[model samples]
Target chain A: MSEPSGLESLYRELILDHYRRPRGKDLAPTFDAESFQVNPVCGDEVRLRVKLGAASSDELGGTDILGQVTWTGTGCSISQASTSVMCELVRGEDLGRVAELEAAFGRLMHSRGLGLESEADEDALGDAIAFEGVAKYPARVKCALLGWMALKDALAKAVAGDSSPAPGPKG
Target chain B: MTGLSPETVTSPTNAHGLCGPGGLPDLGAPREPITPQEVERIRRDFPILARKVRSGHELIYLDTAATAQRPSCVMDAMTWFANNNYAAVNRGAHLLGEESTEAFEDARARVARFFGATPSEIVFTSGTTAALNLIALSLGELAQGEPPASSAVPHICPGDRIVVTQAEHHANLVPWQRLAARTGAELAWIDAGPDGRLNLESLAALIDSRTRVLAFTHASNVTGAVTDVARLVEAARSVGALTVLDAAQSAPHLPVDFRALGVDLAAISAHKMLGPNGIGALYGRREVLEQLPPVFTGGSMVEIVTMTEATFCPPPGRFEAGTQPVTEAIGWAAALDYLSHLGMDRLAEREAKLTARLLDAVTGIPGVRLLGPADPADRLGVVALDIEGVHPHDAGQYLDDRGIAVRVGHHCAQPIHRALGVRASTRASVGLYNTEAEIDAFAEALANVRPYFGATQ
Candidate 1:
């Protein structure tokens, strides 16, 4: 038989594993901030809650520890799996580490399925490396990035203490 | 390639793009079926059809409902015009300008003749969305003041009902919704059945005397159901409401006549009809065109301009307000010419066969539900499917792997999706050139999706 195809590479066993039974699939009862994001194209949505604990001070200047990351969403396998992977990777990590992870993930998504050159960046991404395949299809990048976007927004809302309404979607 | 004689290739089309002797298909011409071999010959015209996708898989293009693939002849026409006569149309006194202007107006005349309309009645717009918005904005402007002494543009006043159908694409529905919001005209829609067909039972009560405009699709982009234009037009006419048809889907697939449909105004996108993007036509009845106010302002549309005020040009010119999509118009006319040469009735008959094959092949697959009518009659080749335990995004990717290009997501018709009780669907639409073998391959690929994804709880 022939080798794995591009679409098969996108839907790896790890991705289907997470999609079937996602971690952080439930909304946390208590959280510092919450953000609701929707992919307008497919109507996929994620309401992500980020809870920050006291600063973890090995390298902390003013960075808060991301104690918990929980979300509730309904979408395609890529979106659901990406959210699951993101929550698993970022929970209990310091804010700085989370930022680095987010940036690295962004680079991976923009890599056009070639993947990150830096081994450290790939290791940091963990299961999200399956999503490098998502970048090949430009339309699906939004689905894979949905949860990460919600994390960014919720963390910003938490930092500013701005209790604004969940920005439903960009007009 | 097999040599094709002129008689074997097509029915005779006159210089004006009308049928010469066999008579117009929309009139009384017998259905001349396009054979599979003829379809293969026609496919040779489209260079993109020969393209390989992904890992050397033959391309199976099933997204013609969104936008059609252009043939080499259309490209040749545009390239020829640009090489020989590229200039600002109807403006410069140069010879090239005159030639360009002649080509541009000739394109308009061809499009008008294609729609059984006069050249003066067709206004070129960016696309279907732009055409719809222009009509809505113009109507909204009319509602702001008294009806013009010479204009037939309907006045949509406060509390007037603007009726639409639930199966309308966002392009048709959203404009009317905005128009109603701006003018205080109450917006309403004919509800869709479970199968996404518009429920005409509600037509009588909805389109009453208080209705100003009835805007709807000639055929639904998502559902593939052709709306009964005559029924809707009759209701609108009895109530003195102007009818607006979103002919973007139907015009490309069938033999369409604006006069025969009896809709006061209609919109059609060239891209969906094997022409280039950024060009479409807004067809208005001559009387309606003569009376309607222009939506866009400035430049070519205006006749005389003072420091304070300006007088506008007639119908078509009044609507086309800037440096026109001149090259695209030429290409669109060439596309019309190509379709005219094919004999629309024959093409329609061919597509219907393809539709029947597609429907049969797809519906036979277990755990797949059709988003439109199962009956292949009245419906075009546009087919949207709801796959069990598989989101359209994932399913679309599955199909894409095999070099099948289908549209996923809500298809910009979220309301109809909601009506059909689906968030989104994977749509496979056929063009005149799509073959039965492609449909079989699509079906086989689709069957593997559920097995690959497993049963999602």
Candidate 2:
């Protein structure tokens, strides 16, 4: 039998807490940018809406500080919790830091559950580090990255000055 | 897709232990169910089942519906063929080529024999998907315009109708949809009832004189419910429509006799039946096959080639284009021989018992909802279930952690899952070699899933 800790590493209490009462699990009536993504293999989906507070003409999506990042979707714990954690991490933060954290999280997921080398990166990941065990499962990596993909897409739409929300989910 | 039959769900217990695969007295088959000893002996043929996974837990394989594990004999047969008779079949005048061609033809003969059909009726393809696509593509070509003088392919006129079922896998459904779109034919379907069974009441309206084709599955991959092929075939025959059966799931667990089923065309996969991958067969009635237009045209399948045009070979040869998976064919023939030796009737009985046990175990869990029929007697051992308040991925991971491999997804049949009110599901299917104990272990693990994920609510 696998050690209880093996599963625990992936389904951390913090992660479970987020999954049980997900953060930003609601659609905003109005948002500057919105994107929906579905992991077709398992059908874990997330639609994220980001409201950028200010645009300082930073083409890199850096000057726009996300005033709010809300989402709504149905999926597994890993995907739902990852979305919750991502929403919490990016809210009130500049798109530049969000991008850096997204990059850092991507590295963490690619770590194959061994975690990252630098303590700085791990610290930056916060509760998101709990998903380290998910990387060992290549199939679940998309679950952890679902929210990030939607965020990236929404941010791209915002940066491109496209204010329209997609009518439905996309894979 | 049905309302929860929780009343049928019992305590997470092994009802099969009291009377397992030893013998299925109630089954109408004259053959006996494979005994526990027989199951053990069968397991010896498949070495992968003995391997450990995820922190050294013994592998409890319950995902046979996705793809069956190949026995050592199958691999050995392919290897032996590769070593001794590996050559371009029907090409060189060399001894190896002659032997290779003979072996390839022999494989076709064996597959045909197993399905109670003649060698001329079997057309080799990559898999069932390819087989169905071949049929649809040929029909599409015929719909477009006239083919060679020899071709007698069915025409799908602009207003003609093509009827399928709601429970068809995308492989079976999409090709027909595309065929309908290309031919300007209206695509209709028999809806699945709340119980996940085909609502045959809609069949009268959907299938009419204008119906050029009626394609459906012999057994649903999602629901595990075996279709009443006779009724469907009778209806199609009444309208003089071409009937295409997707036998991918049925050919594995059921003793699928194409002649007995009376379908004009059928597709089957070998990998799902403990044979090698990348090899399958399309079975057509001898006359039907003779008339069907070839989907693929190339070197091996032609009769004579000219600078501008080439006449095609008859039936099976006409359909098999280019180089074939000769080694895989040999392996699949060996697999058929293995199944033949065991008797498909006996194996089917054994599988029925296991399905009963599996259904009993999975549906017993509080929140688990079966995606198929509750009765195991008429269904295959393929069970796809949804655990409420818990996603299939999480459920699948929990099972995987315990070394119980299961399929977790829409399983390439998204429409059925949607009809069942779920985006995805976890399926635990059984093969002939599976035991009652494994089903218990799966159930025990599955029972804890709700609490483990805190999804009891």
Candidate 3:
């Protein structure tokens, strides 16, 4: 028999695998900027640290590179797996391209269960596409976006050189 | 609106004589413990219990601790009021206005009687949070000697103290913290033991001569643990401190008499007690009401008005400042009538059986660690469980897919969850309409949690 329509799409084996054994889950010892994100409704949280490479002036334009994307969080399968997938997709990419990826993922989340029109966007999201069913639930959408929002906040602080010491993740 | 006939809305068999002898369910004698026949009859009174979810499964509502589903009578009462008797109260002179004001005050008298209080002592509020805020903010003003205080002020000062508990819901905890900050008074707490019961020994030590207020929940909405109210009240009374009871969780499931409970004030919510939302009650002793200055001022609450200054009205009228929840209060009175017809003692006994079954079912499942008291006699139907490896969100989703509704997370009592050594837990609470089969289904769903998360491997 086929699985239930609501459960299978959101809890695909690939998503569960990533959640069971997350990637880049350790906080980086040295980082330019760090930020903590909390889903106050459910008490899920993520403490993310990002290290940025020195800016290089390219022939096309000046671009900032992301040296590492590392995080430690306690949340459900969707949030943990989304964080793992995000770290894998953006670790070695330039900061500008990573921002574009975040925007694309955000659009998919707001799609209300309908996926992207273009295959290019779908291919860009990789395993993140498994979260398409999550958009159907208004409550779970925030879980899929926790890590990406943290990355955006952390990157902004890293560029501003406002890296003052902050308290670690709370229980 | 759905049909309101007994056969259509109520049970076909009418096993409990719901529509038979007396107009309502009889209250003279205690009913037997809940049977399947009783569940069938009670389930028919609530139309929402028959609803189906996405998977074509019947909805099992186990989140009654958050808010309960209203019976058809309560909804019908609200609809009848809106259709026949909608008017702005206390400000109009027409026939409808007089009718509306009469109905509103009559509802207040009924609610007051339900809590063993006088109509003048009960103030209608938006809900429990608003009621608690009204008390806390007014106490702060009373301490400041606002509006030229009478003899009622506690006169809190720099060296005074306010005592609460670690397990208080944020609604009760945050207000007292703000009161302490505003008055420059020290804040203290009664800690909980491993079983989630308040430590009365610590409470005795905490209540001193300088303690002005002692606030706590009559029952924990998260843990299902009932507090020792009389003991705590005695401690506060010995020191001349006022006692404020959060009855939001207890008023629905238990028989509560604010006067007999010996607390100076109590807060209750209508939605939790099977009434409409946006209406609750603040019960204060006549003397305590005199001491608490009005926090919200305007319109009907004022006794005399001037460009620069105004004097407030008496106890309840002084607190009800604006256009009140008139229709909601009428419906709440109907809810109280419904409760009384069924009998609070019988309802409590039935809930005890359901809670015992839920505890046994969940505890028998492997890897599920039940929080709060192990004895059903000690706790009510709110059961929070910690599955070893499944986060509460995941567990909640797993159960939701199976058409079981349970609350997951810290449940607005974060400090207690921290004390219990977990980020969050899944809670399955019951109301009067819950059945044994539903409890079995919930436990079966919970048993599948670890396996679904692949933790068993």
Candidate 4:
């Protein structure tokens, strides 16, 4: 195979910038909802804390998440940057729209496809699209997706009201 | 013919001096009794040591724990057999077949002498892992009483225990875990103290009447701490447990006598002991071997075959099922001969001195911590250390740049690393051919590790 230029693109300055100075980095004292996610292979961890505001049932059913999302965790640059980008995208989106974004990001990270469903809003994903380069390096894909998976877990735990304290990051 | 002195043959320095200023050692140095110098010269007979690596850098191989570089004698022995005496052993009357069979059996005899065991007790294996697996499988058979029934065999009931120690390599530990899983047996371990020594008191307490088998290492590959085999064997006997010793590390460094150690069975790999890869030996007492059933059975091991049923050969042959690593075994035998010519006692002494030098050098460095026993006498020449604030892989890479090779990470003993409260440690191990000058260079390289890594005192 030809030498991969995507690997070089994956380590680009923009991605590292997000990693070094992540936006929306916080740990809520008490969360409306939270989820814990772990990348079992390399032990990268991320937790998503969400605060959902009251909304009409029709608004909830509609695919536009308009809620506050915050994240905190320890991980490699890819994981941290991805979490930062994810926080920016999902902060003001509806819960239903957040779930759809997570599914699309998973597919993109796994290199399944570049296209999201036509009905799903793609504009909210924003800088998270930069991680598409990570698909070329299988070993680093977990680093890129660690935060999104944590957000998924935290949302589920927040809804269930059974979120235990997130575990500390360790090798 | 001019009688060449043993010293002249052994010491490269003496040989070079005798031959000329820059040629091979002098053949006419003052004839000392067959000194270690003679053994040193014999080592030069192996050509791999002379090879260049990474351009002009001479290959400074310090990875004997992983596998040893083979000598010319071993390589030639195997190549000769494969090229000339090529045939299936024990099944043909042709000359090539007979020659192959003799070479294979002769290899077994050489290995038996090396380990101070009888040929009847030695079973040729693929490697140490396979040998340990064979023991576990055979023990499992006895515990279950599957076939080729022996009423005298000890039965492992639900509450019976198999004892091991925390310092064991995973190859030694995992097999017993599987054995315990298969039978209703309980697996327990004697914890290593902070100094990386097995706690004798805890070992004594752990081995009670219920303990069926007590297995442990002859030495820790991670810590390099030599376990007190005599005391541990006594403790195992007190509890009526059959002791199995993992001599993978020890067999390469010291003289291993299975009978003298008084263990029921021991496992050793040829590759670790300056031999070719893909061959190891399992030494079991004749009585014990007879009692244990064959784990893998198909060809070669069978004695009498019928349409419906087949009987197997006794002990060593029965256990050695399928086609063996015949040429590898022969090469291993040659490697043992190489060790024998050097004398194991002297080799151990040289290694002890190297270990002391390594310990002193590493401990002298600020922010560098040597794992296991700090005292040189307490361990083998294998030195495992951690430089403060620097990951082991980084240290390994740094050393690599300096042409100093060492192993890093948990050394495949993860539980021990966890117990020691470190993610990983770097190791520098020595072999028979290693010199004091080499040790000095290694120590010098290690001294530079902290500053290179930018670790604070």
The regions of model 4 sitting more than 4 angstroms off are: A1-171, B1-43, B51-56, B146-153, B306-308
Colliding pairs, model 1:
B151-B291, B152-B291
- How displaced is residue B15 in candidate 2, in Å? 30
Ranking by lDDT: 1, 3, 2, 4
DockQ of every candidate structure: 0.75, 0.72, 0.79, 0.08
In angstroms, give how far residue B122 of model 3 lies from its true place: 0.9
Which candidate number would show the highest DockQ if scored against the true structure? Answer: 3
Clash number by candidate, in order: 2, 0, 1, 21
For candidate 3, lDDT tens digit of each residue in B1-457? 1112322221212223332211244456556655677668778878899999868989999999999998777776666667766688887777667767777887898899889999999999999999999999998888777444435447789889999997799999999999999989999999888878888878767899998889999999888999989999999999888899999999999999999999998899999988888999999999989767899988899978889999989889999998999889877887787777777888899899899999989888888998899899888898998889888988999899989999999988988888888878999999999988899999988998899889886
Q: For candidate 1, report its TM-score.
A: 0.93
- Which candidate order results from sorting by DockQ in descending order? 3, 1, 2, 4
Q: Candidate 2 - CAPRI tier?
A: medium
DockQ of 3: 0.79
Weakest 10 consecutive residues of candidate 4 chain A by summed lDDT: A1-10
How much is the TM-score of the A chain of model 2?
A: 0.90
Q: State the C-alpha lDDT per candidate.
A: 0.85, 0.84, 0.85, 0.74
lDDT tens string, model 2, B80-152? 6777678888798777777777778878888998898999999999999999999999888777775455433
lDDT of 1 by residue, B1-457 (tens): 1221212212333232432211234544435677777778778878899999987889999999999998776776677667767889888778777777777877888899889998998999999999999989888877888765544557877878999999999999888889999999899989989887889999989988898899999889998999999999999999889999999999989999999889999999999999999999899888887777788899999989999999999888999998999989888887887788787878888889899999999888889999998888969889999999888999998888889999999999999998999889999999988998999999999988887787533
Per-residue lDDT of candidate 2, residues A1-171 (tens digit): 443666777788888888899999888889888898988777777888888887555554547788888899889999999999999888878778889999999999999878799898989988888888889888889999999999999998987888797667642
Q: Clashing residue pairs in candidate 2, if any? A: none
